[model samples]
Every structure is written in C-alpha cells, then in structure tokens.
Target: MTRRVFLSIMTAAGVSLLAAMLLILGMLQSAYTQRYRQQLRDEAAYAAAGLETGGTAFLAALPAGSGRITLIGADGTVLYDSIGTQDMENHSGRQEVQQALASGTGESSRYSATMGERTYNYALRLEDGRVLRVSAADFTLPEVLRSLAKPLLLIAVIVVLLSLFLALKLTRSIVRPINQLDPEHPDKAEIYPELSPLLDRLSSQSGQIDEQIRELRRKQQEFAAITENMQEGFLILDRDTNLLSYNTSALRLLGADDAVLGQSVLGLNSGSSFRDAVERSIAGEHYQRTMHHDGRYYQLIANPVHQEDGIIGAVLIILDVTEKDQRENQRREFTANVSHELKTPLTSISGFAEIIMSGLARPEDITHFATNIYAEAQRLITLVGDIIKLSQMDENSIPVEKEPVDLREIADFACERLSQAAAKKHITMAVHGSRETVSGVHQILEEMVLNLCDNAIKYNVEGGRVDITVSRDPRGAVFLSVADTGIGIPQSDRERVFERFYRVDKSHSKEIGGTGLGLSIVKHGAAYHGATLSLESELDKGTVITMTF
Candidate 1:
C-alpha cells in the first residue's frame, strides 16, 4: 500500500513538473521570437536609412559579424550582398521584398534546411525605390531544446528526487496509523475521520470472529467428551479415506497407535472386509460388515457423511461384537446339547416302561425295569433342575437374597451330601481349613460346593482322595479349593471345562451318570459372588480347581 501511494504521488509530481517546464519553455520561445523579430525590423530600418545616406559604402563599413544584408533594385535584382557570394538568387520572388515594395516595410521568416535554423527577414522600401533587407538566423525550437538538454536533465533529476522525498513522507504519514491499529481493539485507534468507519467495521468483525472461535472451541470440547467416553469405536475420515478423528476405543479395537491419524484408514487394518466397508462409504454408499481383527469379531458400520454439496467424507463405527458372537454360538450349542441330554433319559425311561407294559419281561424283569425307569427319571429331573438353575443365573432371575455364609459350613455340607457317592466310588472325601465367611446366597453357595464335591468323587480313582480347603489367602480373600486325585483333564480341554456340557472325558460322560453342567454351575456361582476361578490339571495325575471371593 505504501509503495503504491508513493508511486502515485511521484507520478503525479513528475507529470505536473514536466507540463510546467514545457509550458514555460513554449512561452519563452514565443516571446523571444517576437522580440527577435522586432530587433530585425529595427536593424533593417536602420540599415535602410544608412543606405539612403551613405549608399553602398555604408554596407561596406558594416562589421562582418553583422547579420546578412541585401540591397535589391526596384526591378528585383540583387544590388549588393554583404556576404558577397557570387550568383546570389534574385529577391524578386521573396515575400518580404514583395510586401516592402507594395507597402513601406515587410517581415517574414523561413526555415533554412541546410543550416537547420529559422531565418527571419525584415525588408524596408528605400526612398530610392530599392529594398534593403536584414536577415537573422537562429536555431529552431528543437535545436534550442537540444542545446539545453544537460540543464533540463539536471532539473528533471532534481525534481524527481524532491518528488520522491515528499512522496515518501506522505506515504509514511498515510500508512503509519493504519499499521499502528490493533486488530484486537480497532475501535481504540485514533486515526483519520475517513478511516473511522473502517475501524468500526473492523471492531465489529473482530468481535464476531472471536465469538465464532469460542463457539467452535466449545463444540469441539463437547465432541471430544462424547467420543472419549464412547465404548464403541468411532472414526471420522475424509473422502480419501484418511483418518481425521477417532476415539480411544477405535485405537484399541483396531490395534492402532496415535500415529495413525492423518494416514489412510487401511494403515490401521487392511483386511478385505474392513477396506470394503470404508471404500463403499467413501463412494457415498452406506456399508456394514463383520470384520475379524486380532481374533475378535467387530461390526464395522460405515456411513457416508452428506452435505448440500454431496458426500464429502465418511464416518466409521466399530462395535466390539466378540462377546455377542460367542453368546450366540453358545446358545446354539446349548440348545442342541439340552435336546440330546433330555432325549437320552426320556428314551431310556420310555423303553423300560414299554418293556414292562408289553410283558416282554416276566415279574423278575419288571422290578429291574422299574428300577431302571426310576433311575432314568431321577437323572432327567436332575438334568432339568441344573438347566433351570443355569437359565436363572443367565437371566439374573435367582430369587434369593444374599447373606453372610461360612465357606467351611458350605464345604462340610457338600461333603456330607456327596458322602454316599464318595463311598460308592471308594474315594475319600475330607474338608480342611478354618471357617471363612463370605456374603452370598446360602442356597447358591451350597449348590456350588455340592457340584464341586460331587464331580471330585464321581471322577476320582478308587481309593483316591478329595480335599476341600476353605480358608483365607494372604490377600485376605476367602479361598475355596477342591483338589482331587482323578483322571486329570487334558491341556486342550482344560479351558473348556467350565463351559456348559463340556466334558474332559466325553466318552465316559454317559456312564458317569451326572449332568455335564457341574463345573459350569460352579463357574456361574463364582461369578455371581464376585469370585475368580482358576484350574490346575495334569493328565494321568490330578486336577485342582480354586475359587477366590
């Protein structure tokens, strides 16, 4: 701005100065020409007077430096020429001579091409009927200016320098106040009246901008709070699939680091389904897919972000559906297992009853068939009861209030109830450790302990021992452990033992005459009591299951 203003002022000054110089020069040229012409007339008249008195001798007496002089006869023949050049042109056709002949005196000027000068001629009609002429030659206007070129150039340089100095001062004065104005407080600046309106506008705009910035920051904070607290992974991407914004859950779910920001979404997970979902969303289509990442299933829901101009980007939501998927699979497996387990008992009962009803067996066979039927019916009832208990736990519909219960009492009760089974298996059962009280439903704890003891006796070797320990660990946590000398679980089947209907020895599960939900019940009851369950087992050695509350 300053440079433009300075240049403008300099240009105006230069133009004005140039015009003034040209005007003055033109006026001086006109005035000088007029004055020079008058002198020529005076010289011509004086020469004519001298010629009238002194005749040709007067011309001879004139100084050589005098201007050109000519005497012409009335017949228009050159009588005397001061320069004395031979064969001089006749003056008959000369305008000044013709005019002097007609009148008393005449003046004219012409350009001499050879000399490049303007020649002024003044003619006087002598009383002797002859013409006396005096002529003077001077450089033309162009020649005069050329001769004064150095001085004019010096003057122009001086003017330009002065103009530049003044222009600089003016530009500084004009621009300084503007530069001094505070953008944050434009209204407080003391400046030109013409700039007051501009300052007011600046103040207004600044206020508006500040308010807008604050609003944006507030909204950004709100967005951050919402996203940071989200459990599901959330991501925002540009049209090019570059990550723009993301939540912590997204980083964890995708196994990505913070460095993934501003990088392509594929950098986080380039799996086919993940890439497909993102690409489809970027193409303005909504897409969803189940993507398996890090051995966990994730539901990727990609939505195109739309505005008036069309789809500009995309939003990706990744939900950790691994638990849901596992539950679904469990439900299916449990349904099939329950059907097979129930059908087996009911089929055995039905077959035995049919044999008695059909009279296929005699009176001796009838009692035996009845005993088998009763046993199968009992097994069915137990299986149904276990299923109901598990269902109740699953739905959290157990209608029992919690109370402080002694772990030793529960362990002793379990040992008593399963004593007959232990006797039949020739397995020794014992409870050790002091009383450890925990807050729990009494019935649930008893059932959990019963299941643990029952499994220990049922799966033990003859003359093997089952030890139930009820005590407090060093951490003051109530610990209950059921260790047995039984056919230990294989390494492969150890982790699955706590799942419903999962058995370490599936081949002997039917002959074992027990529902497969024993450990599962223990697991659920432990979870309900806020306890941690751990297992240690070695094939052909023994197994130990511990619960800490």
Candidate 2:
C-alpha cells in the first residue's frame, strides 16, 4: 500500500511538471519568434531609408552583423547584395519581394533544413522602383531544444528528486494512519477523515466475522456431541480416504486406536472389500458391505459427501448387526425344525392309517394300530398349536389385555392338568407358597406354568418330584419357581435351553414324546409379560427355573 501510494504521487507530479515545462517553452518560443520578425522589419525599413538618402554607398556604410540585405530591380533582378559578391538569383518569385512590389511592405518566414535554422524576411518597397529586403536566420525549435538540453536535463533531475522526496513523505503521511489503525477497534482509531467510511465498514465486517466464527464453533460442538454419543459407529473420511473424524464407537467397531486418526482408513482394516467400498464411495457411488471384526458382524455403509464440484469425501456408518444376523439364522433353523417335527408325526399317522385301511393288520392288531394313530395325531395337534403360539409371540400379536393372575392358581392348574403325565412318570408334583398375583395375560401365564410342569415330568427320573412355588422376594415382586428332580441340564447347555427346538438329550427326545418347544414357549411368554427368567441347575441333582415379575 505504501509503495502504491508513492508511485501514484510520483506519476502525478511527473505529468504536471512536464506539462508546465512544455507550456513555458511554447510561450517563450512564440515571443522570441515574434520579436525576431519585428527586428527584421525594422532593419529593412532603416536600410531602405539609408539607401534612398545616401544612395548605394549607404549600404556599404552599414555596420557589420546587421543581417543580410538584398536590393532588387524593378525588372525582377537582384542588383545589390550587402554581404556578398556579384552573381545572385532574381528575387521576383520570393513571397516577401513579390508582395512588397505589389503593396508597400511584406513579411514572411521559412525554415532552412540545410542550415538548421529558420529565416524571418521583411521586404519594403522604397520610393524608387527597387525593393529592399532584410533577413535574419535563427535556430529552429528543434535546434533551440538541443541547445538547452543539458540545462533542461539538470533542472528535470532536480525537480524529480524533489518530487520523489515529497512523494515519499506524502505517501508515509497517508499510509501511516491506516497502518496504525487497530483492526479490532477500527472505529476508535484516529485516522484520516477520508478513510472513515472504510474504517466503519471494516469494523462492521469484523463483528460479523466474529459472530460467524462463534456460530460455526457452536455447531461443531453440537455435531461432536451427537456423534460421540451415537450407538452406531460413525466416521468421516476425506477424498484420499484419510480419516478426518470418527466416534468412539467407530474406533471400537474397527478395533483401532487413536493413532488411526489422520491415517488411511485401510489402517483400521486393510481388507480388500473394505478398501473397495471406500474407493467406490469416494468415486461418488454409495456402497455397503458386511465386515467381520473381532468375531462381530458389522454392516458398513459408505456414502459419498457431495458438493457442486462433485464428491469431496465420504461418511462411513458401521452398524452392529451381530444380533440381527443371529436372529435371522435362528428363524431359518426354526422353520426347518418345524417342518421336520410336523412331518414326523404326520408320516407316522399316515402309515398307521394306511395299514389299517389296507387291512394289513389283523383283527387283534387293529385296536393297537388305531390307538397308535390317535396318539400320533394328538402329538401332531400339540406340535402345531405350540408353533402357532410361538409365531404369535414372535410377531408381538399377542392380546394386549391383562388381568391380575395368581401365580399359585396357575401352578395348581398346571399340576392338575399334567397329573396323569406326572403319574405315568411316577413323579410327584405339588404347589406351595402364598397366592402371588402378577399383572399379566392369564392365558400366557397359564401356558407358561403348564409348559414348565410338563417339561419337569417329561425330563424327570422315575419317582422324581416337581415343586411349584409362588411367592414374593424382598423386592416385593411376584415370582413363580418350578423345581424338578430330573436329568439335570449341563451348565453349557442351560444357556441354550430356551432356544426353539433345542434339546439337552436329543437321542431320547423321541422316547420322551415331548415337543422341544415347551421351554421356548415359556421364555417367549415370560418376555411378553415383562418378566425375567432365571435358571439354576446342577447335573444329577435338579433344575430350578424361576420367573420374576
């Protein structure tokens, strides 16, 4: 800014000085030329008067350095030349001589290129028929300038030096106030009045910029808070796949440390599929893939961040899909198990009926075959009913209406219904404890108790006992506990006992004549009623399953 101002001042000064010099030189040249012409006229008139008074001898008497003098005859012939010898050209064609012959006097000027001068001529018509002319040659404008060149250059140098000094001083004066102005408080600075408007605008813009910066910071903090607390892993990467931002969940899911930040995303997981997905997203394509990290499944979704120019970066979202995948796998397994379970009883019933219809059975075997067919059909009905109940519970389509159901009554009813089965196994079943009423669907509660008691009877040893207890814990929560002296479950298999179609003893499951879905039904029913189920068991001892609501 200082240099610019200095240059501007110098330029203006240069132009003004040049203009002044030209104007002065032009005026001086004009005045000098006019005076030279007038002197020529006066010389001619004086010489003419002397020639008329003292004859031709008067020209010889004229002083030296008076200028050139020529006398012409009336016949257009140069008769006398004051400064030269004989032969001379006629002056008839000369403008001044011709005009003087026609009128009383004439004046003209002509430049001589060869002599580098301009001649001013004045011709006077004397009383005689002859004409007298006086001419003086002086340097032309170009010659005049050449003669004054040295001094003019010296003067220009002085003027330029002076101008440079003034320009520097003026530039500093102009720029000093601006430089001293406080950017933070432009309005408070003492500055040039001419710059007041600029200062005011700067102050306003500074405030606006401060406000904008604060707003940007606030939004950044808000965004950080939201992403940091998110359950899903979130990551932001630049076009080059460098990690720009990431949440803690992202680090955990990717199994990476803080060093991964600012590094390539490949540092977290260098798998080809992960790299390919990131590359595709940076190329403006949305991509997704399932990645296995640390034995957990993650759904990795990469979406391009776009601007008017094109894709600038990418956002990667990693969702934990371990549970979801497990559920899907379970559903497929359950479908297959249902098909197999339903088919077995159906095939048995079909075969038994076919034998009876074809009369392959003798009269003595008819009752036995018919009875087996009825039992298989009844088993099929029970399997189908359990499947339907499970399906309803899984879909959350169970009746929402609830009533106060006594746990003791449910236990007693289950024992009564399963008494014949318990007697067949030589198992004694009893219900104890006070009536504990829990708010739940009565049908679901009844099914839960019935399944528990039935499972105890089916899995029990000969002459085993089943105890159903309904009571409250210190927390004042209603609880129902079913303990059975049965072939106790192993610790490892106990966790999976509630899974559909899961069985501890798959070999004797057929001999037991019980669907493996009883515990699963009880689990689903307890979950629907917002109750927590716990199991305590030891091998060769007994299994105790409790539901607390």
Candidate 3:
C-alpha cells in the first residue's frame, strides 16, 4: 500500500510538471514570434525611409548581415537586391508586395526556397511608388523549441528529483500516523482530520467483527459438542479434499487422530469407493455408498454444497448403521424362509389332492393319502399363525392389558396342555416350585410358558423328563426356568436359538414336527415383560432356558 501510494504521488507530480513546461513553452514561442514579426516591420520602415533619401546608395550602406533587401519598380521589376543577385523573381505576384502597393504596408511569413529557411517578410510602399521589402530568416516554433532542448532537459531533471523527494517525504507524512494507529482503538488514534471518517468506520467495523467472532466461536463450540457425542460419524471436507471438520465418532470409526485434520481426506482412508463418492460430490453430484470398515458397517453420504458459480465444497455424513442393516437383512431372510416353509406344505397338499382327483392312487391308499393331505394342510395353518404372531410382536401391534400373572398357573397350564405330547414321546413332565407372580400380559405369559414347555417335550429324548421351575431368587426377582433332557443346542447355534426360523438341526426339522418359531415367540414375550432370557445348553445332554423378571 505504501509503495503504491508513493508511485501514485510521483506519477501525478510528473504529469503536472510536464503539462506546465509545455504550456510555458507554447506561450514563449507565441510571444517571441509576435515580437520578431513586429521587429521586421520596423526594420522595413527604416529602410524604406533610407531608400527615399539616399536612393540605391543608401541600401548598400546598410550593415552586411542586415538581411536581404529588395527594391522593386512600379512595373513589378526587382531593381535593387541586397545580395546583388539578378536572378530574383518578379515581386508583382508576391502577397506582401501586392498588399504594400495597394495599402502602403503588408507582412507575411513563408519558407524561402532561395534562402532555404523560413522568413518573415515586411513590405512598405515608398513615396516613389516602389515597394521596399525587408525579409529575415527567423526560427519557426519547432526550431525554437529544438534550440531550448538542453535547458528544458536540465529543468525536467531537477523537477523529477524534487518530485521524487517530495513523493517519499509526503508519503511518509501521510502514512506514519496510519501505521501507528492501534487496531484495537482506531478512532482514538492521532491522525489527519481528512482520515477521521475512515477511522470511525474502521472502529465500528472492528467492534462488529469482535462481536461476530464471539458469536462464531460460540456456534462452533455448540456444533462440536453436538457432533462429537453423536453416535453417527460426521465429517466435512473442502473443495481440495482436505478435512475441514470431523468428530470423535468419525476419528474412531476411521481409525484416525486429530492430526488428520487439515490433511487430505484421501490419506485417511484411500478406499476406492470412498474416493469415487468424494469425486462425484465435488462435481456437484450427490453420492452415497455402504462401506465395511473395522468389522462394522457405515453408510457414507456425500452432498455437494453449491453457490452461484458452481460447486464450492461438499458435506460428508457417515452413519454407523450396523445394527439397522443387520435387522433389515434378517427381515429379508425371514420372508424368504416363510415363503419356502409355506410352499413346502402347500405343494405336498396340492400334489396329494391332484393325485386323488386324477385317480392316480389305488383305492386302498386313498385314506392314507387323504390323511397326509390333511396333516400338511394343518401344518400350513400352524405356520401361518406363527408368522402372524411374530409379525405382530415385531410391530408391537398387540395392545397389552397388564396384570399380575402367576407363573405357577401359567406353568401348570402349559404342562397340562403338553402332557399328551410328552406322553407320546415317553417323557415325564412336571411343574416343581412355588408360585411366582410377575407383572405382565396374561395371554403373552401363558403363550411363553407353553412354547417353552412344548419345545422341551418336542425336542426331548424319548423317555426324557421335562421340568418347569418357578420361584423368586434372593434378589427379589421372579424367574421361570424350563429344563429338558433333549437334543441340546450346539454351542454355535445357542446364541441364535431365539431368532425366528433358525433351526439347529435343519435335516431332522421336518421329523421333529415343530415350526421353529416357538423359542422366538418366548423371547419376544419375555422381552415385552422386561425380562432377561438366558440359555445354557450342551449337545446331547440338555438345555435350560431361564427368564428372569
């Protein structure tokens, strides 16, 4: 700024000096030209007087370099010439001579081809009816200015030096107080009066800036607090792909540190999909991708930030949706499993009925085929009912009418209901323990106990015993546990026992005559009652599922 101001001052001085010099030169040339012309007129009048008194002799008596003198006859013949050359042209057609002959005096200036210089001519009419003309080769404006070049150059150099010195001095004088001004209090500084308005504006702007900075800092802190604690990872990037903002969640998920800030985002994780998404977003396109990082799933979304010119930057939002994605996948698999399960029984029933209708079966086999068809139809009905129950539980669509439910009553009722099935399997079923009461939905509690007991008997060893225990522990918690000597769940399948349609023994599932939804139903019911369900099992030994309320 200082240098620019200095140069501007110097340039203005130079232009002013040049303009003044040109003006002075022009006026001097004009004045000198006027005086020179008048001098020529006076010299011509004096020679004309001399000529009238001394004739041709008086003309010869003039000084040597007095300039060319011509005396012309009344008939337009040059009779006397100061240079004494007879080769002179007739003066009758000359502008000054014609004017002198008509009006006694005339003057003009033109270049003389003979003298090879520009001349100012003055002609006076003599009393003898002849013209006396005096001409001198004088300097033209261009020639006069050329002759003054050395002096003018010296003057310009002096002016330039002076201008340079003043430019530096004045520049310092103008800028010193400004440089000394305290930015914190511009208005109170000692400065020129002409700069008061600027100082006042600066002071007002400084206050506003401080206020805005405080507000910005507050907002930034608030934003950091909110984003840093969020479960979802968040990130912001500049147009150059540098990390602008991020949170703790993002750093943990990306396996980065605070040092990664202001570094290229591509350096943090150079996955091809992430890079592609960033590129697309920077080009003004919205992009998203699902990435697997650190054994967890992340949904990365990139959205372009736009302005009037084009895309300026982008925003990247990373959401840790591992649980949500798992649930969605489970839902899809469940749907598929349901379809396959329902289709199997329906296909069997349809085939049997078609065989009967077409008379393809023998008469002796008709009853057996009819019984098989009926059993398959019943299996279909049971599968449909279980699906509806699971769906309702998932949607929480069943309204609960809560009450204190007696676990002993629910257990006894479940045992009695499964007695025939237990007897068919040669398994002994008994309810052993005092009554335990829990706050729950009655229907759901009964269903939970029945499913647990029924599963125990269905998957039990032939002649194995199924026991139901209901009691309160020392912690004042009511719990119901069903233990069975059955084909126990494998270690790998134990955790998945409560998941719908997840059967440990898929090959023998049909022979087991179970829908595989009983334990899943028990789990949902127990959860709805704020109960904790646990499983202890060993292959070929037994399994115990306990629900503590």
Q: Highest lDDT: which candidate?
A: 1
Give the TM-score ranking, best first.
1, 2, 3
lDDT by candidate, in order shown: 0.87, 0.86, 0.86
Error of 3 at 46 (Å): 49
Indicate the residue-level lDDT of 350 in model 3.
90
lDDT of 3: 0.86
Question: Which portions of model 3 show Cα errors greater than 4 Å?
Answer: 1-207, 255-259, 283-285, 307-311, 355-371, 432-434, 473-477
lDDT of 3 by residue, 1-549 (tens): 556765786688778877887788788888988887788788888888888788889999999878789998777899998876568778898888999999998878899887788888888888879998888887576786688889878977886677677777888898899899999889789998999999999999999999999999999999999998897778788888888888888777767765467888887777787788788998889999998888888888999888898777888888888989988998998888889898899899999999999999999999999999999989989888888877777787777778988999999999899899898989999999998888888988888888898888878899999999999989999879999999898888888888889888888888887788888999888777789999999888899999999
TM-score leader: 1
lDDT of 1 by residue, 133-215 (tens): 88779635785688789998898788778877887888888788999999999999989898998998999999999999999
Per-prediction TM-score? 0.86, 0.67, 0.60
CA displacement after TM-score superposition, residue 358 of candidate 3 (Å): 4.8
RMSD of each: 3.5, 6.8, 9.5
Span of ten consecutive residues with least summed lDDT in model 2: 111-120
Residue pairs with backbone atoms closer than 3 Å in model 2 (clashes): none
lDDT of 2 by residue, 1-549 (tens): 556765776688778977987887888788987887777778888888889889889988888888778888877798887766465666788898889989978778887443356777788888877888887786367766888899888987876787678778888888899889888889898987899999989999999998999999999999999999998999899999998998898888877776466778878877776788889999999899998877889998999999998888999999999999999999999989989998998898899889989989899998998898898889888888899898888888976688898888888899999999999878999999998898888998898898898888888899999999999989898889999998899989988999999999888888876778999999999888889999999888789999999
TM-score of 2: 0.67
Q: In model 2, which runs have C-alpha deviations exceeding 4 angstroms?
A: 18-236, 244-249, 259-262, 280-288, 301-319, 415-434, 461-476
